[model samples]
Target: MKKVIAIYPGSFDPPTNGHLDLIERGSKIFDELIVAILRNPDKNPLFSLGERRAMLEALTADFKNVRVDVFDGLTVDYAARVKAGAVLRGIRALSDYEYELQMAMMNRKLQPDLETVFMMPAEQYSYLSSRLVREVAKLGGSIQDLVPEMVERRLREKLDPAIKLQDARKMKPGKRA
Candidate 1:
């Protein structure tokens, strides 16, 4: 029997509980699940590629069938290179469904043999997203429930320095307030 390998590609700046939920579910569905992180140079990311990979690796360590990897360029191309038979995606809302549908169609056009599988995270994490997690962390809001403990710590470490720098700039040179 041929092993079914699935690639789940995303920027994953800071992988959230929603992402973990998908990974857990996908791991059970596929023989192997590769959590591929896209290295996009155009957009500035909250966490470095290494940091993101590290967090995903740690978060998914318990899933023997799941692995974390980094990739650049087109996701379909990477999926082809890895011999992945399907691409796994998560849809949390109507907006996501629309976009994912378009991408899935385009990917089919590019690689007719590859399939796209869409899954929804648990209802509790239906509204969760990495962007929202980053926004909350950046504004000094609590994110304990949105992400794992390790990710929360890393987010704080990555954002605290910037927050301190911004606060330092706001203070007058000689004034101690």
Candidate 2:
């Protein structure tokens, strides 16, 4: 029997609960699920590649069929290199669907044999996103429910220093305000 391998590629910059939800589900469907983190230089990510990789590795440690990896360049290219049979993606809403659909079509064009599988995360995380989680954490909002505990801790450790610096800059130098 042929082993079914699927690649779930994303930035995963401080992976949120929504991402984990998909990974958990994808793991069950494929013989092996590779959570590939894209090393995108175009966008300024909150977490470093190593940090993101560590977080994902830790989060998915218990999943026997799941593994985490970092990749550069095109997802389809990486998928092909890894010999993945399919690419797993999460669709949160219409906006996401439109974007994903275009990418999936292009991926199909790029790799004729590789298939794209779209799955929706649980209803509770339909609106959850890594960007939103970062935004909320940046503004001193709680993200306990949006991410795993380890991720939440890492977010605080990563963001709190900058937040504290900002707070310090706002305070009067010699006055106890």
* RMSD of every prediction: 5.5, 4.8
Q: What is the per-residue lDDT of model 2 for residues 1-177, given as tens digits with 9 covering 90 to 100?
A: 999999999999889999999999999999999999998889899999999999999999999999999999989899988999999999999989888999999999988899999999999999999999888778766677889999988887889875565456558587442
Kindly list the per-residue Cα lDDT of model 1 for residues 1-177, writing each as its tens digit.
999999999988899999999999999999999999999999799889999999999999999999999999988899989999999999998989889999999999999999999999999999998899888778766777889999988977889875565466557687443
Global lDDT of model 2: 0.91
Query: Over all chains combined, what TM-score does candidate 1 have?
Result: 0.89
List lDDT for all candidates, in order: 0.91, 0.91
Q: How many clashes in each candidate?
A: 0, 0
